[model samples]
Target chain A: MTPPRTPVLGRRSLLAAGAALPLLARPAIAQNSLKGTKLTILAGSWYVPENNTQLDQLAAEVSKDTGMEVRVERFAGDELGTKVASVIGTGRGADLGVGVEFDTYLYAPKLLDVTDLAEEIGKQYGGWFDVARAACMVDGRWKSLCIGQAPAAWNYRTDMFAAAGVDKFPDTFDELLVAAKKLHAKGTPIGMTLGHASGDARSTNYPVLWAFGGKEFEADGKTVAINSPETIAATEWYAECFKYMDPGVTAWLDPDNNQAFLAGKCSATINVNTIYLAARAAAPTDPVKKNIVENMNHGLWPKGPAGRYANYNINVWLPFAASPNPEGQKAFLRAWYSKNFLPNWTKTGQSYFIPTFAGFDAMDVWPDDPKLKIFRELNKLNRLAGYAGPPSPAAAEAVSKYVLVDMFAKACTGQMKPAEAVKWAERQYDQIAKKRRA
Target chain B: MSATTLPAAPARPRARRLASWLDNERTLGLLLVAPVVILLAALVAYPFFTAIRSALSDQTLADAGEFVGLDNFANLFQDDIYLRALRNTLVYTAASVVAKLVLGLALALLLNETFPFRRLVRAAVLLPWIVPTVLGTMAWLWMFNPNFSVLNWVLTNIFGLRGLPWLTDPALAMVSVITVNVWRGTPFLGITVLAALQSIPPDLYDASAIDGANKLQRFRYVTLPLVMPVLLTALVLSTIWTFSDFGVVYGLTQGGPMNATHVLATLAFRTGLTAGQIGEGAAISLTMLPLLLVLIVWQLRRIRRSAVA
Candidate 1:
């Protein structure tokens, strides 16, 4: 009679354990398959050291998740491009890494086709932005995964703007010019880098060029359209604005503007949130830095006659075709892009890296910081180096040669007239097109 | 006895042959020089030939391009940036070498005289040269910074004068880079010229004085002539180094202020490596060879002439 009363509690525990077996075995099988795999990732050292540390932590977590060993090596921003090119050429270094702007197009044939992974990421994260698609898709194939972009907004002094009778940041190019003149006359000029700076020079100049309806090439991507009236207008505007900016901006490298803004030598400059973040980090120990944190704010790029446009440096994740552990590389990227990881990574950047995923727009990354709100929608306004044209090798060459940047610089420095600068840029573009055709 | 001699005779013949070969002067010379020849082939010839081959092709970082001989060179002639770089290189080399020569000679002459702490002063003069080029360049960069320049602070605050745009202005950027180059390179010239000065017998100065030669007169006639060979060699070497100078300009200006300071080496790097146009970069580097070759040949002939005299 007692045997008839079965052990209900033991039976229930056994059934629950049986139900979880498949879920537990799935990971064990994956780990066994990738037990001996190793992946080496090369990333450019971020301006913020914390970003690099976060990447390292993520790599370690990924290594533990899948029984594959993962390593990340970082190099300076200037050297990263050369290192990536070397690895691609030799096919002996780095299984996966973050590549420079438009690298997908430059090294498309040598990259792994990650269309499936990219699509899955896009679907899971609402979708990829059009700019991301433009950057990573080459000839109808996804050559790389669009990671994020660093928006260089107008980092300015709020008190300085108010002191000059400007109650708010300029909303248009004309307003910006007036504000710049006022600020310069007050002895705190706005600085925009027009030197051969790899990042700031292009970020500022390209937006100005595109905002004025000037493009390096026509939509067809072959015909040179840089000598148009729109380009001439943009060059002329910059030349006039140059008179209001600090003359030292011509020599400003990537770091100069940040130094100038922090030193109070300039009232405003185009830069990433690093300036504001640096000020905040130092505020606790230094009274001057505290004052800077309270006074500084960031604004969207002023709208131009044609439209508002921004040229943030777009980065992508590149998996080399020659990677030995291809499966592990893809799996690591999957885990890295998962809901459990990417949101946390995005928050750590503090708007330094505005995620390209459309879904991330809903995520509360910059929760109590209103100063960083301007950068949230910056991805919507972004256009790559070759705006009207395809992001091809020729466009990349022109960009590397500083054709557009030089056009503005030549005019601003009074080395040439606006028309002459446009003409010179046109010739450079023509040469690039000819070479690409060859 | 015949059986034992037969076994040993073969070994003796081989040993005798080896010893005779070693005694041959021609064979010994060849054997001694073989290592150097192989080293040169591996280190110098291989890279040189690879650069030439790359220059001849339309290669890029991505693709191994087809042979497109002289096209990259032709493109350079048409490039305004290349033309500007050519002008900048000549200016940079000519200016740096001339400044280093004058300043270094003055330093060497001062060191030759017995002074308080002469050994200390002599060692101190080598500090710029001994410091790594990159580290020295970084210190100079801080000094030349637009906002935080100590030079500007002294000008505006201490001297009660307006601050100068040391690096922002195109002309001044060229001057700033040349200034750093001179600061770093003059010590090399000074140390070499000092060695050469020590080699000149002290009796020469006494002999010139006895002949009623004034100080300037003695320097022009005696010191100048004797120092000419070593000085010329130093000048030639300095010229080559300055012509191919990259670190100073790259570290300071990165050929900026509208490419005003872009020497050939920096421009080639930007065009070839940074732009991924490998062939064009190689072509830009090759442009330096011809000018350097002529300078070396002229210097070699002069050195030989001086030795014979």
Candidate 2:
């Protein structure tokens, strides 16, 4: 006002004010964005305390970065699917849910489309595995994200095998059966699942079926192929194998086999690495741990008649369509994929969670434990329940019904003859196919 | 006489209107219960009707099913597993209920005696009932494990008996599930019967004793008759609960040993939630209704007869 306003001073004042305005407004904008941000994820208690710890760590890191509160609710794997479905049916649930055999694709319309994120991840990790693609892809789009593969292996007692005079894990199903019978005579019968277990029944039974060349459905997806002669042979062979297994194998779920192995009751069992992880996590002085560490050995599923095929327990993470915080979900996915988070999570799992992405194959978690070397083949020689067909709703229904597993179980349990059980399962496949057709 | 009635007391319009309103008891009753009626219809009736409709269709978790008319029901009858489930459910409910009644009555009789720490004993007896079913079932599951089973150890080592396959063999799996159901349910039956036992007039027992009735005779005659109403009520309630029990079996055996233990509830769960055959599951669940209605009718008749007697 005084001395003929300096042009430079005016210009400087205007520029400074313009810059300061945005700076002053930035806090308000951030405050508004962060006002009530929150997200909830229904995580499976897949690996127990370790899975819980990793989830907490992930949540903490996510909260720190995004300023969004994250709530992780852990449910047992057996109950998680029903809980997720119940909440979904009511149109109320956490922002995201993870399921192993829940077949998230069955409820694709209720899930948020993660095509862009999934594609980006696929590009980053090379292409996804065929099983992963089958599990997550629906209607030509990715409906969920493949989290990990719970690779199944024969967690057998080396001492038992040695005592039974078996030099190695059998290379063929017949050899394995002979070894199992020898073990059974020794009073430590091999424990195999012949029940309605989502994981064990599928993991143990599917391979036997696939090896014997029994497909749940034909490639057409409409024709039921489970009652074929190949399946009948598989059933008869499995029934014989059942004789060498613990009588209770028919009632055992996924955890039973692990417990049986740990308790020194079973010579061998087909299971995820939870058995190994539990033994490893035990106190150094724990006898169970010592026994397992010293006696336990891992092997690939024995070659079946057709060839060896392993039932892959593929778990997927699905974001709900009703989720209000897609931003938070996206952010969490980004955090989950980071090197800082995934390797640690995989390590915490103790090989129970095999990274689906090939990029993480070099993680020290796998190489550190010699036992885990077996898991490297999990994705390589794996098949899901509906191998010949896509994981269609009908296939999902059949798997959920434990159609193939029941066929084996019924035969083993003497509830039905091998042929009758195969026929029974074929009828189930027909019903599911009919529903899908309708 | 008509004239003497004071010309019928010229009625005010207000009084006439009030009388008319009050005299219409049907409308008044409906108006009074409208809220509750509407609430019940919204809550109970709606879902029930929806389930019935869904059962007749070809619905999955994804699609709104088209009406396929008795197709779902037709499919259910052909399903051997469903037939097995129906049989298993009946066996489970019958075995569990009978076992619970016998054991619960024994427990009530034992607890009725005067002794030191009797209150503590009663409370301790309630522990199984008070502990959540799923948690209790989990403990039993551990105890039934083929390797670490405490029960097996007790039998094999202590009793010098061979280890029994508690949940492995088809016959044994049914036994194991029934045993567990009895374990969790007996306490409820005991506590309720105990309450009923206490409420019975002590004078009646004294009278029965005076009439030269022995302990068994007193129980057979006086105690039973007096406790019959409560016992029947408990039995009916227990039957319904046991018939529909899902958690215990699901948690323990999951209807396994080749579908030996699957009840209607687990079958429905397997069908609808697991198999995504929502329509078939609903049909399976609704199958419980006809039988359940029969039970309710039976219960009501018994209750009315008892009330009259």
Candidate 3:
């Protein structure tokens, strides 16, 4: 009696409009809010050049969609950390950038909190991996968006393994030692960097440490537990293994193993998929590359006495707290995580950038290539640099200092006994902890 | 009116007075030097003071940090890596300077001789110094590559010897880095010493020869004394440069194979920038000041004493 009956067409129109609300409203709001604003991103130059081109395209697309000026600056991977640190300290620089490892924790206080954005992306992507959360979440807040991990596995030559009388890559460290000796005798020795290389050195050595039940810290993330018997055992094992490896492993920087493996100088080495991808890329032109492409396969990191583990370098997208246009930065991240952008970017990496989302594990990218299949499970066993401890600045400092790598290197090189090496690393950890406490 | 009138003294214009003032020696000298003083203040003094302040404090890359006085310095000694880096710096600098002086003096003496395309040879000698340190070091890096080293290839294939671990063994890495330092640095000393060698009067050599001095004696008596001052100067400069060298070690080895080659500069960079401990890094750098000061002071004293003699 009080109101006239609403028309069927009108109710239908209202329902449709309500359903279309977000689709219509989001872009308009984002466009207007960010109009005339600018977004600058600083990223480490990717090993795959196409990844950089794809990111640039993404920035261009985001700019066009939001009417914001967007720019991306690329630097060498090693230099990006220092640049980001400067940006955080000065409260100026790029609005958004890529941070390596647990840099989110290293600069957490000055990083923009993106909990809502992270949750939204996670919900859409079937949730982030535990490693991603461990890398980016600080104090229960998402401080950065984990882009993906560059899984470091043993990229081996199958023919060499066969020639050495090993049918497959070794499954355990003990077996790996025996295989290494045979491979050495066969003149195709295994190589893992024991140098100060930020990527390969830590990636290989940390797993060995963890596999032997040694950790840099107790679970409390504060105590120095590196001087334990497990560490000495790990060191001793590494020293014996060192006897059979290429003598140059200790001097290898991040790129040396890739060069050695590609040149057929080493039978097996711990590295990311870049070496395989590179070989495949060169196969058509170079017969040697073609041969390498055919003979090479990726293997899981050898299991240790404790357990199998990995320390893949995790890359994340961090927005600075000093960003003048926080909303615009968040919008760009949203667009970045969208299906249109992320899938293409992930594909461009050719599994080198294993997406941090668990949903990506089922994606066609991993299964399509047999060599990359090893990477699908790599994230599961992956641990942050400071195993059994929070990814704190102290741990990052220890990593930058190359403590664990040096500990193994010293024992391997006979600079110190395994026990002394363990003690040396323990003292380093103690000093780092003491400084952090102060 | 004509008889009583005296010419009124001309009043000088303000612009003319200013021009005269500017023309004065003291004012002109100061004006010429002002920009340089300002530049040094901005580029050097300010940063130097800031570094000192940082060294005194607990500054990190992320935190402004509070002053902890000498705690950072005290802790540096306790840190084995820092101690190792200190020792490396000494050994690296000493070895490099000594090698460079010998090689550079020999190169200068060779270049000073009458030879075909002498100018061309001198220019070619400068190629190492002219090439950027990073680029040249990268070439050396390849030469020292463990698997594909051309140096090793030559050693194994031609000499029928085992390939040495040029960059792998701790002792070898130190040697490799020092070799690079001497390689790059010798040219600088050579060029500098050659200029001094050319300036020495030919009559002095003739006079020494006429006095029955042999070629060796002539060099020992006449040439040595003449080039000694210049050689000392070159040695001082080379010592400073080698002591603070970051590029050669960083490029070739990056203080690796167990920190066998970490000089002060690379260690400071690793600690301060890479590790984000700005204060400790600054402290490490500041430790260089006293050593450098002693060196500079001794150099000046020697120069003064020689001049007086």
Candidate 4:
């Protein structure tokens, strides 16, 4: 039979056999399967300029090191969740995602857990950075490694502080009130994105809870336990905290807060610190920008009885566990986590992007800068969920939707007494928890 | 001969004989329609039944949610935002339908008259309808920017009115969203009305004119009556569409400014995708189903009755 098929003895048959050999090994076939594979890195348009470029560089790095191809795609942050959901719902090409915080939490179950990859970051980056480490963990699993921290703290115009009167810094919440009043007397509004929009309130509101020693849950290092006594206080104080905000402050969200800060409409606002560098550059020539750039302070979150908690915000790059190469994904994490690689990456990102690894000297982010340097110094005291605890996404949503915020808004509007509002919020929060459990 | 008189044919047998008339044209028509009946049952009826069943079940994919009977529906009623969304959805639907009808009729009327560049103008009318919804919504958002907006720039810097937070301001956001939806939807209305307008006989309008009717009177009589059924169809379709619109609101307000602008579609999306409570979202969406069914059924009945009338 073999002799009858004499032509198969030629080099073409040998080549065919060689080609046919890999198809037989599922593992090898899976390996080769990813060679031409394209992974989408979805980013928001506001961040398109920086994020797309970084992702492109990452793809190049991955291609060079692992020879795996990748691509960077961008869309408006507003559209990312809906688009990703619709596509994924249709069983379409939703290969991977890099989303902002809300969408990340919203899509958690759908995402790949890159726990091992993040765990190995210690070997690469020489100990995961604490702030980054904390935020990236969920239920004690290192689902992601925080490549950067977007610590939300009260940024102020140091010039306004000087103009208002004496102030080194307000060390306590009470003192903050006095200082805030002085700024108001001097006619500078306090800024916050308390608007009911999804992103505006969630990212910026936690500090008020922390400052008031309130927490939805207890943090067992990384695990979040919802509903605690301190959380009630936090909710009550959150209402109080918004009292001094500028009129229509409830309408403000991240971009609105950014704009107010840019326009000098506010003496202080809490937000991610990424805008400092750009504000400085753009404000120099533009009067609006100048108001933001010169004489500003990226100070610590003002102290409450619980202590000043720079509410930590971090993002982790989680390669899917479903990746064809989990081991390869780990290798990629190792590359990302390398201590030597971080300075360049963080520097490229700029601002106080507290990198994941421990012992990273973040001073370089604001080395000589006056205001931003305060953030570098103060970032050490940053605590996760104000040290009371953090809420799982569902728990947080439960409390947020049913309780605290609505009462806080009422309290701020003077529609309800603060104490009455606090009690109402706590009761509502309890109901939300009970109902959700039910 | 009297005893031999044939007994009257049994009523049951006669009826059976009459019913066996499938060999007749009416039966042939029903036979011809049988494939469609089976097809519609397979495609539409089956899914419709399942969606209704799922709506009754409280189970969600996340919890591998266990069925809780009508518990989900009960919860849906308790939510204040859901109620607000329902109200907004109704308002939005009514507003959208009316706007589409009025704008569509106006455009159709304009296009009906002899005019220069008629073909170009007609093609241009379809531009908004043709552009993708997401893209069109985004373009509308750019125009609605609170600060640094071209619209605000014109209003504040040029016209000198104080700038309004078109999206961020709660008072204005809902109206702004409705405006954009109508802008995108009116073209479909116009195109349909124009098609309907073409179908109207020239003789009726000429007769109405000869009867001493003016443009408005002729439109009020001949034009209005002629196109009433088509307009009704368009209105019903647009109402259903606007009531469930997710993309425009998703792209524009995200049910924001304190969720004041949320409609049913956006609420469903936010709850399911953003909140990850798929069961709850499914529950919320099902609440809208009955309203849609009633509206559609009424329209169908009206369609049939009008045909007979």
Model 3 misplaced stretches (Cα beyond 4 Å):
A1-29, A364-367, B1-13, B16-29, B299-309
Cα-based lDDT at residue A194, candidate 2: 78
lDDT of 2 by residue, B1-309 (tens): 577876557667668987888789997888899999999999999999999999999777766769989988888888878898999988999999999999998999888889999999999999888899889999999898755788999998999999888887888889999998899889989988999899989999999899999999999998888777788888888999998899998998888767778889998998888766789899999988877788899999987886899
Clashing pairs in 4: A129-A356, A129-A357, A214-A230, A215-A231, A216-A227, A217-A225, A283-A289, A283-A290
Reference-based TM-score, model 1: 0.93
Residue lDDT tens for model 3, A1-438 = 011111122223322432443322354335688899999999988877767777777677667767899999888856788788789878888899898766787778888889988887898778998889999999999999999998888999999999999998889988999999999999999998998887898888999999999999888888888998999999999999999988789999989999999989999999988898888878888899999989999999888889899888888999999999898888778767766557667776767889888787666555366677677777788899787888887888899889999999999989899999999999999999998887
Query: Which runs of model 1 end up more than 4 angstroms from their true locations?
Result: A1-29, A32-37, A64-67, B1-17, B301-309
Per-residue C-alpha lDDT of model 1 across residues B139-258, encoded as one tens digit per residue: 999999977898998998999999888889999999999999999999999989999989999899899899999999988998888888889899899999999998999999889888
Q: What is the TM-score of each candidate against the true structure?
A: 0.93, 0.87, 0.93, 0.77
TM-score of chain B of each: 0.95, 0.88, 0.92, 0.85
How far out, in Å, is residue B197 in model 2? Answer: 3.4
Better of 3 and 4 by lDDT: 3
Q: B284-305, model 4: which lDDT tens digit per residue?
A: 8888888899889999999899
Q: How large is the i-RMS for each model, in angstroms? A: 1.1, 1.7, 1.1, 3.8
Q: Choose the strongest candidate by lDDT.
A: 3
Candidate 1's displacement at residue B69, Å, is: 1.4
- The candidates, ranked best first by DockQ, are 3, 1, 2, 4
lDDT by candidate, in order shown: 0.85, 0.79, 0.86, 0.62
B201: Cα error in model 1, Å: 1.4
- Residue A222 of model 4 has an lDDT of 31
Better of 3 and 4 by TM-score: 3
- Candidates 1 and 3, the one with greater lDDT: 3
